[model samples]
Target chain A: MNKWTKLDNAAIVFPSLAKAKNSTIYRVSAVLKETVLPVRLQQALDITVKRYPMMTMRIHKGLFWRYMEYDDEPLRVKREDDYPCHPLQDRMTMEALLKVFYYQRRISVEVFHAITDGSGAMEFLKTLVYEYLRLLGKAVEPEDKIRTASEDIHPEELEDSFHRYYTPGRPPKIRNTKAYQITGTYFEPYGNNVTQGVVSASALRQIAKKQGATLTEFLLALLMYTIYRQSSQDRKDQRPIKVSVPVNLRQMFPSKTLRNFFAVALFEISSQQEQSLFKILCAIKEQSVKNYSKKVLQEAIVRNINLEKIKIARFIPLPIKDIIVKNRYFLYNDKLRTCTMTNLGRVDLPKTMTPYVDRMEVVFYPTANNPLNCGLCTVNDNMTISFSRTIRENRIIGEYFRYLSQEYGLEVKIYSNEWGISD
Target chain B: MNGGFQINHCIHCQVTVEASLQECPLCGKKLTNTRLSVPRSYPAYALHNKSSYYFQLFWKTLVPLMFIGAFLIPSLITLLTGEGDLWLNRETLGIASAWVLVRYTFLSRMHMGKKFLLQIMNISLALFIFDHVGEARGWSVNYVIPFMLICSTLAMMYIVYKRKRLWSDYAVYVMTLIFLGFLPSFLYLIRVTSLLWPSAAAAGFAIVSLIAVYFFLDKNFRSYFNRRLHF
Candidate 1:
């Protein structure tokens, strides 16, 4: 129940991706030094999880609004022995784990954006690895560490579970995003398989700057353009390509819990015209950041969180809540635009656990119902872009990475559950 | 709603654009400031600007029907051992068949959700009766039977259309009737069948049709598909 109180942190950003409904869980795997966890890292995770237990909370009721607070429950960790990694066949070598279970060599954690954004999850992962390394007596320093400080908890902050983090207002009106690509529909496979690829963070940023775009703008543009190119080639008609981007509501609203705190915004580009890389990047950046002002985001936060609180307090039986949540899937399916590209910008770790820790990799596997899965994770100066799909579209993924390298001058190193080029 | 106004500068290219313009409009950098006194509006009734629906009917009907078939086939098998009425059988099969035809015949014609629902209902009635008659005689309304009816009715529906009548508009109303009529059948199918084929098929149909309709009907699907598919 106190999970809502954890949203008070400035770094808790989660993006909801309805792209793949059945494969909703996203996982980030890190190999920890087999020693005991550093006290600081362990404490940080304990604090982070306890503060936002909603992240670990499951839907006890309601279909679309399926959020429940589980405070007294202990964090469930699965041993690698219980859940082994199942690798896939093909260029995208993905390994799917059943769920998050920690064992001797590796630990895998599954997270849903309804709880937190990519950035927020990366923050947890960095701290976890840092602490794990420190426990083994490894000296570490984050090359891209922005700032260092002691426990800088804002004292006056009350443990109000529903405090607004962003400016307040109404949810932005939903827009009917027209699909611009033509492709057959397919479902995500049931097994848990994941593929990870990493690029130097500084290298990506430098590419973006060189192209006169921000890192996100450049990345999104590369993806949109690539998908557009691949999907359009086999048909006579050309539709606009849409890329769904998850927006972190925490920065725009004021909730401190680790529940579903995100919204989706779409970036569209037409293949009919001579596509301009710079222009497309600019357009995506505009749509992603500008469509909803801070006030608008704030209003949505207050309205959504308040509605949940009211529903819970009204005692609308659990069965009724379940029905409501199920129906919501249909509503969300239509209202949300297509595809997903989640960016978990930069991660931070404690001072004591830096040296032994290398970089990190993050992959997002949307619920099985989604069309495509995209996730970006950064640690130190490296970023890994991972994508998963129930149906295979190697061409789409291939074209996407190719465009990233060709257009932005950023060399993309490819990796998969099947094939990967090691650095 | 910050007075619907604000100032913004593109993070890159230093391009300045008024809040009214979505992109930089110059260097094309996305502007963070979207607030403005006057909200930017598309052409009044942007929906009106949609292209005429022609081949869109083929896509719409084909998409949804394919899914209905995927589900109906498996569910029919399960229903053989389970308990259900002839009316349910005919109704579901009839609806499914009619839906494919109706989609081919009407959904492209109509743009309204309510109207489409109505069209689905119309087709379900006939399909219901036809399916039950066959079921009561112990003949399953699977594979060839439903497919034949749907394809025939759809082709016939178009035949009835006068040269002046647009295929898209008429298909809309037809689709509505079929959807409304077959909805119950679909539900029954879901209940009696654990196989997710119908759900998958229906979802697949919607998704494929969604893209097809966008390009074929609204965006001139064939042209768009050809242009995009080629390169």
Candidate 2:
């Protein structure tokens, strides 16, 4: 509550790179069985903001760096308007870096990346929905998964976990990475087109088990294969379809901070067209296992902290640092990834809350360079795979959904925000 | 598919579309079954209406139009008309004034109090520049800036009073405007201006506004300074 705090290590990179075209905003939503009541939702949000005071902080530029300060204005719960992942700028960031919106049956929380990562945002969404359900007179308990309003705020929740766990001078376990970037005609009004596919979580897990892999490894291979199938025969082996997967570090190292504490693990599949998806899944599992050694994560934490700790980098004015970051982003940020996919794995709610909730979705905003990004989460028995893109052509999406249906015989129920299509 | 939900089967895409959508979001193929439908998972959003479409077009052309409309068109007309007064002409001043005001007022996303102070300063600057170089080179500071400062202070005081909860956040800006209101007095005392009454009125108004705020909202101003220092 004392005025301001520094941006987390991973969060430092996003503010400099964010713009209208390359928004670093990501969304996590829950669709309840009943229609959303705005009044009750607003009340829930007001309570939630008090419980999580960090959500009310706004980022401001200092002479040396950007930092977050407590913004005391009351938070407004907006009725859903505009397309998803429109840039959060100026007034939006000035008010608060996080926003909560509601549609027909959907209550969504869109977060600026400078504030929190996917895991942290998911925690906020779950707590918000829990409070909403309670306000509606439901008998839902926190059940240890949700952050309850009655519980005392712990100091550990505010610690910058990345800085806490960074190990200095550890050499990175690196690899030669070059990925194929998806390109298509840009949408006239720049916005994210979200296409989500809902399937049975148990069925997805069973199928992954049949292929001798975890759900993430299985989906990572399938995504690569889908993109590979769409390419011409001449371009099939031209480049590896690499997916940048974010792994939550709380599982490995013990930390309860609701901030960015995750690392990226790159999984690739190349020249595996002749093999079945099962073989590709096995190969991806192997590659992913090798890439995710603790050394790799330690190096990521160290490197990120080191970049900001450079003596000269700190003294240089923030505007000049932003220019340097922007120039570097245009040259290299998305040059090595086909797309980004962050899976929340499994979302568990209190037993009493399950009947009211239908599904949960995590939709990441696609950057201009990396035109396609995927996010998915499983709650109860339903798994939703959401692909958000900034392009006109959605052939990859159609093919991915179709492939999941025809190959695994997984019943795919598809829906979208329909940003671009006229009809 | 298991919930007896009215769903669309897209044969081409080979996926079952939710009942909310009339066509496949991926393939654009119409729903195979056209019948009475259940509630959709999402609202049927008007993706782009006429106003929004025009706005999109305007947004796309805004940058190029800012350069051409603000700079090129007026300069071109002046060149063709043989009125080559690039910096000091009436037409040029009018266009520049419009451009600065429009950009700062309409486009800036700063906090409302900050933006208001900046806009008033911008207008005062333009007026000062115009007055100093013109045949009449004294009115801006002597009358215009002092009056503008007094008005700005009153406006900010009103905002602070109306939005009591926001007083803590906006009080600093009001204080800033009060500090700026002394500039004309400084100018007059330094003999940069001949008239002292206008400067005196402006500073007198500013001090009176501050006294009123302090006298009435003593606790509020105290807490304002308490929260003023940032970590």
Candidate 3:
């Protein structure tokens, strides 16, 4: 018999809204210096799977709720033949929520959001690369952060940290107001077109410091400014241009759980106000400094957990709960913000393994309504900013990178998934 | 126990081993006694037991209790009212059959063909019981069930046609539908049902569908059959 566990608080919304267009899946890939050997990769994955027990489970249906059970099926590593962030067909596959695919020197791990968040997925990817390097006869010593296959999986890694950190209090509700939305023609065959911009980490940091804002604040301001400039003018209704930024709670709270322990911070700027770049950056910096504070994030966490703790919500059956959750998510996506921007922050690896690995990138899938999303991660001073969009128009992505090169005087190497839109 | 060293290290990987071991787990390097004591880099923590008792209780105890109560409560109410008849018994059985149907549809982790077959059987059984208990009318065996079987077979065929690449995956399901399509004629022949048109219509449609696919879509049909039958 296999073991089973209840779905975590953050994961409860993903299973209901999972579809082709809105897969809620993300990818983190590591580019190695040598070509990937499939046999060695499979061997490494077999060993690594034992270390991450939570990643080996499958979602199961229960009487009042959906739970996850350990799936004993063998996981297979495949070649990358499909588009990035394709929906995980658990029923068709081995019932695993995450998949490993390799192409040339790159090894990618795509995980359904129901399993884990970006930070947790990155941990898995890092450990996988560690194991892969070891299998390849590379002298990869285990580091402080990397959990090797020989070590026992920690209890904290499997815990639902949200439940542990949730405090019962009357926290002010986050507003759900409509923001300026981007409209465009969707790509054919319903695929995500990823445009990755690789820039120098020190140079980007210098620019951020010069603007008197952090990298995240600077990027948020640029994203909002780009949207504000591109959005069509509707004289009757003027809404604020907003971007949803996911904050990793592990930094604020003392928890090492691999499950989702993150909160989203919505940053908005008035579209009607004619503001310069400096004014926008100042506004973003002020709001972000206040929002990213511990007190504000704790309030956000309390407000989110309070929804799950409602008396009526606890007793409601799974089917009804799914409907309620889906409706809440739909409303959140439609009215809460224009788009999402998630920063995985700097990823550090063991010194011994650095020679074998090149760099890393993170790609987030877009929702049906919000057709574009941005994910950023820095590895070995190579900051890769990935834009994943389902829309045909790449003007925003083009302009964003162009702004970095032309205005900011920073060299940005740009590439794309090349979805081949004839238009 | 040499006085020169208190630590064991792998000669190949050059990493210190925390536990007593004969070989290095990472590179199969033989352990050797070393003079320097190196601290273990990994944390000392027991692996968390993955078993969840709450999930076990919900699935093993609560779900079965709910399944039983769905039938038991209604029957108990019917009996306690002192207005019991064959109707209550039939209703209880119908509810139980409906529960089985729903359980197989949503809960059972069976293949698509097995689920479809189970659904067909459950629906037919429920209709048979209802027809027998209500008025002994042959409408269930006569028109309803045969029509349902033929319509479902057509739907499955249409689905297979639409998903041409997955025709092999649905071949067994289509074959099962064809086998079920012949079942209504058996009922008619056994004198359990008096209606001949419905059975003939269902069987005829199944035969025609089989012939059409085999003749018109010969290449796909042969490929699907060969792959599904493992020939």
Candidate 4:
């Protein structure tokens, strides 16, 4: 017998929408100062999985929807061989929804979206790395920052905060328009190619503060402007380049559940008339301020929870509901957004564990509709802006990094997984 | 790690990116500067192993093509000869259904007990259809259907007894199979099935099983089905 849990309000859409081409798996990795030892990593994973019992389960299809069943067995940590964020194949079986992989000096944790969000994944990664370092006899302390193996699992960690925060019968009317989509050739051998540009987080923050914009807003404006400049001369091409920004709700609510408790805020802008990047920044700033409010964020939570509460939706069989969700998911989503950019603002590890960790990277999985996505994660002073894409043309990615380096004079270092690069 | 001392700066983009590449990946410009070699942050995934993905894609594509061709070739021959109105004659339908049954059995990741029950039901349906159109022979309802229902019920009981841990999950399916066994007796009462012995056996076994389960496992199944069929 296993303890079962339901998928959160924001998580129910992922399992149906996932396909071979569009695997809804995101990764959070940390490069260590030393090479990864597989045996020690496996031991560390066993201990860490026990610590975060909420993430220690496999996804199973239930009568009405999907649920997670506790797997008493330990999850195996494999050596990294596949492309980053490839689909987890043991979905319907007894394997853990989260996988731990090691390649040389990097340790990556890839998770199916149905289990948890980025914040949850990050906490698991931090704990796993801490245990791995401590196992190797490094002088690392939890400093009460990392969840150690001895701590008891909190009931609040497994709580679905969305259901707690949502108010019944308060559905807000949302207006959505089709946005300008980025078009490019689908790269052969279908994989996620990650290209990361690392720069100083403080220096970039100083520039954003001078421009009267937050770092996320400034980056969104920069991305929108890049696409606008590259748009064709036709009038139809001047559509709003909408970037979906996922707002972590732990900041607003006092709940500390490690499940999905985030709401997406769509940052949209376009240039019907000729507009400068400054104007784009101003537009993004205005929208961000409004959209970042607690009232609007509450509306987002209410809107999502209301969809799951439809009278008819509860009675449909899981198989038929899977078909309906697969066909209708993109119609209501991804069409309204050009791409997504999720910023996991600065990750602070305990000072005792800082020297062994090099830097961290957040990899957002790209979908079929939105072929490119950006993930920002700052550790120590380094902010890595990783572009995970499935298409061949990288003009938007190329220009964004160049603009950051040239305009701001930030010494940006770069690396890639090189999935489809010719040379 | 900032271990790169060689600045492979692309003058075309006027920005430095990779420290080891011979050319900039963005502009494809020649930025070959070699001084200190640094280990890469990510493994070079340029060497892609296309076997697993392409193999799955191959079967998914080829199975549908084979199914289409199987239907089309016979239809084309019949249209050219003008010998048939329905392109899928009895034999062709049987062959196609057999192929589909085999494919479903191999491909479905469903629970085993449910899959077994569904497979037997499908086979019984094909037998029923075969009797209806072929000779109007009463063999399907008279013998084959009732016997299959009886045997499937016994098999379901054996499975439930063997896997008692998953008995709750299998409880609904096993009970459904037992209830389906009573259908043959109904057909006999309606005079659609004239042979009384096969129908009596199936219905008798179903009644005995029902009595035993009600006496022995009533409390168990009552609670299980209550939550499952609540909606």
Candidate 5:
């Protein structure tokens, strides 16, 4: 709430107008060698809440106007041994053991985009799981560096390591004039708030590397081709598509408040003609990497923040100011072409906790307000690009994943509730 | 100017008094002299068709007027039969007192004057109808017949105000029933009442003419009255 915290969170991002209501999921399944007490999970949540207090609350307002807090009780974990278990955690079922349910097992942590990005929340979750194990008397080494470190680290040092591991490729040349419509589709059976998880970080990186594409590019290509394929089957007008890719602006700006800290870079692909599975994926990868550079992200951040500062500087009241800004934002949206493709980088857990944990999977469900739902998942040297069919058709999600494993020579595994029959 | 109507000031109160008044009604003030001045309107809010206005007119105006007339009509008949002093002193004083109250309450507001007259005509006609119908059947007019007519009219008025439906919807039905049932009273009022024109038939036509003019008049009568009737 202070000036410094507000500046850190200024880059908070939303999906294109089309996918505004969408929420991404980051679900990790770890095999605890020993039983972990629920008390340990609560303690870990208490510690995390003390640190990043924004991740511990639910969205309170309507479809928009989101804020965050750490006041709510922590999210709960379910034990499979309990009869008639929650349908959400059925995949991570265990026969015998103590289940760690933080702040009572019935709570949920629904984060609005204004608060924290998926990467930030994933980090919080990783630390939480790690701390829970330590509380259970399991051999655990604490994360000393991040705990002691202040959030005022330099942006160059942060991106330097990222650049070393993954080369900052040229961003894609997006071509579109109209904005993508943002929307969401709610499934009653997803149990409170759940998104279908797929893709592993390693698998996507390897596939993206093989295709001479970055992980984001490969995913964007997959999304564009899948949508192109789906729309073409219906014999609809073959229109050029655009997807919104969120850019983290935490370092470029000078703060690390857990509130919104992201800008957006769009990736556009022309669907002038039908493209082969591999061809579209390659194009997507090239364009996405090119669009997601340091210069591009920084420019986007500066342009938006300056506009916001100028807008608020006007003497109009907050509500009227918000309306004018929103109307202007809408006017610019007509140039956008298609959907959204978000790629949260490799979810990293503590070095010492690898033995106790296996992998993490993230699933994204855009709101019914948005017409598209493409989720990215990366875990244990493999990646799965899962798309939800609640809004559009299932064939698009099915064919896209199928072609990734089939045509690309990538070993991809597809999992759904009731084998593609979303129940 | 000297022959025209003059307003007077009350001797005791020094308040501007009406030209017609011989004594001040307020503060027991007495009038000293008369002078010609414009008669200021009585500051009264009058709604002719509203239930409260109609009810007040009925209780304070119509009922008293009709009851006074009831005693006077029979007394006039008795006087015509050469019994002039038969109704004097006690009954004459009562009827006179009732008539004075009726005129002051109902005829004070100009907006309510026409509607009140029409209501009186309707009630008189209803009584005539009951009398005629009973005489034709060789039976005397029963108490229940007149009582029912009064009750029904009051009830219909109550409903009209309560529902707030358009006047054209249900107002026609109620008016039609009253007109059909009040034939004899129409004849009687016309024959006896000198100030109300010669006959009930003529009075009825005049009433209808007034109603048409009031509803269809291009002028805003409410605004006109509001201006002229300022306190």
Candidate 6:
């Protein structure tokens, strides 16, 4: 019999909210120095799935909740044909939450948010690349951090970190004040227009250093400014443009579990007062510093856990809970944030394998209501800023890079899938 | 330059190659070096195919038209013929309700269990409305609802028993079904209808099933309750 495990607290909300438009899926890709070999890639994937058993599991419905169970079905790799971060309909495929796709020199792993977060996905991607290289008879080292397929699966990798780190206390309640919302005509055929801008990490770092802010803070400030400029300026009452930044909790708490272990912190820039780039960067720096602090993050963890711990919540049937949670997430999380900016930070690979890989990109799926989202990751001093938008208008994206080129004097190389939606 | 050809370097992989190729020969990544002021890897323009949008548009336009046609044709016949009998209008309403139920069952994106519950609720409501409109018969209350409650309870019990690994998961659903099965008996006790046999049978079946699960399958029952009721 296959082993079954209950979903962690953070994963409880994704299954209920996933739909065609809002899949809650994300992609992490590694571009190699050579074309991807399908046979070798599949062989590597078969081995990698055994190491990350949780990623290969299928979601099973329960009375009051949903759980994950091991699936004996084989994990297969296919060529990239569809758009990135498409919905994973269990009935239509092998029932795995994670899928491996390859195209030309790029190998991508797309995962439904219910299984794991970006940190977990990155680990899996690195291991897969390592194994693939090894299979091709290339000299690759494990580097101690990369969990290889040959090693036995550790109990720590499967631990539910939320339950492990949860402390008994009254979590602080957050007010549900409405934030600014971006509205636009969605692209036809329910597709996401992916536009990636590549730039030198050193250049961005230099600018950020001059401004006395980190790269993430600098990017968040730029995003807020872009949204502010895009919105109607005639209105007297303008809500603050809030960006939801997902913070990986592994940095704060000591846990090696490859599950959904992350929390979101909202960074708001008020439109009521006209602000310069420096002022916006300061706002982002202040909010991020306070929110990502140990005490504040602990409270956020407690708040999320306490929600599931309520006696009444446990008794409520899954169907009813699904509707309630889905609506609540739509009203609170989606409406309260103008857009989400998730930075995977710098990606480190094995020294031996670094020469074989080119660059990496992360793409987040757009929600049904919210059309635009941003994902950033840096590899080998190359920063890739990827924008996945479902809207027809590309003005915000155009203005964002424009500001970078004009103000910061950084030349950006742009590539796009060209989704062909016009304003 | 060899044969009047220039060379470009891939900034990412550090591989140098010919400039004629759009991407590097070693890595499939697009070349960074270009003669143009601004370099772009892919094409600058794309074609918009709105077929999928039009497909959704077609369905959106068709459903209302079908609904109007369903109501309009029958009412028009009655109006033109000047018939005194309004039974045809009542029959049309029944058909419309049934159609609506069928559409809901097919169109809804709910889970199987939720869909089953919705089916039970919709069927019961439709039968009750039919009973009141046509001769005020008590078949819907005394037989159909009780029968549906019993079948649903039994189906749920079988599913819970078969999926042993998920028995604890379905404990609450099975318990709720058991309680719902007895509601028909409560209606009978209040003297709302002349019939009592269906209610008695459903309630007895529910009670016996619960007893069987707790007594004969004691071990499974205990484990399920332990996991489900764990604080």
The per-model lDDT (C-alpha) reads 0.47, 0.80, 0.75, 0.80, 0.44, 0.78
For all candidates, state DockQ relative to the true structure.
Answer: 0.01, 0.33, 0.02, 0.33, 0.01, 0.12
Clashing pairs in model 6? none
Error of 1 at A6 (Å): 13
The weakest ten consecutive residues by lDDT in model 2 chain A span A229-238
Model 5 vs. true fold: TM: 0.48
Deviation in Å, model 6, residue B52 alpha carbon: 4.6
TM-score, candidate 5, chain B alone? 0.23
Candidates 1 and 2 compared by lDDT, better number? 2
Best by lDDT: 4
Q: Write the per-residue lDDT of candidate 5 for residues A263-372, one digit (tens) a residue.
A: 66766655666577577776665665566676777555555444434543434443454565455455555336455555566545557765665334444444433444
Error of 1 at A8 (Å): 13
Error of 1 at B20 (Å): 54
**TM-scores of the candidates in the order shown:** 0.51, 0.85, 0.68, 0.87, 0.48, 0.77
Interface RMSD to the true structure, each candidate: 25.7, 3.7, 21.9, 3.5, 46.3, 10.0
What's the distance in Å from true for residue A368, model 3? 1.4
Q: How far out, in Å, is residue A232 in model 4?
A: 4.3
* Clash count, predicted structure 5: 58
Q: Please, what are the lDDT tens digits per residue for candidate 1 over residues A269-338?
A: 7767777667788777677566467754555556555455464534654446445655665455533444
Clashing pairs in 4: none
> Which tens-of-lDDT digit does each residue in A190-211 have in candidate 3?
6777767667888899999987
**Is 4 or 6 the stronger prediction by DockQ?**
4
Q: lDDT rank, highest first? A: 4, 2, 6, 3, 1, 5
Of 3 and 5, the candidate ranking higher by lDDT:
3
Off by over 4 Å in 3: A90-94, A232-237, A420-423, B1-231
Candidate 4 stretches with Cα past 4 Å from truth are A168-172, A232-235, B1-11, B14-23, B28-40, B44-49, B76-91, B105-122, B125-231
Candidate 5 chain A lDDT trough over 10 residues, lowest sum: A89-98
Q: Could you give candidate 6's per-residue lDDT for residues A377-405 as a string of tens digits?
A: 98877788889988777778777876776
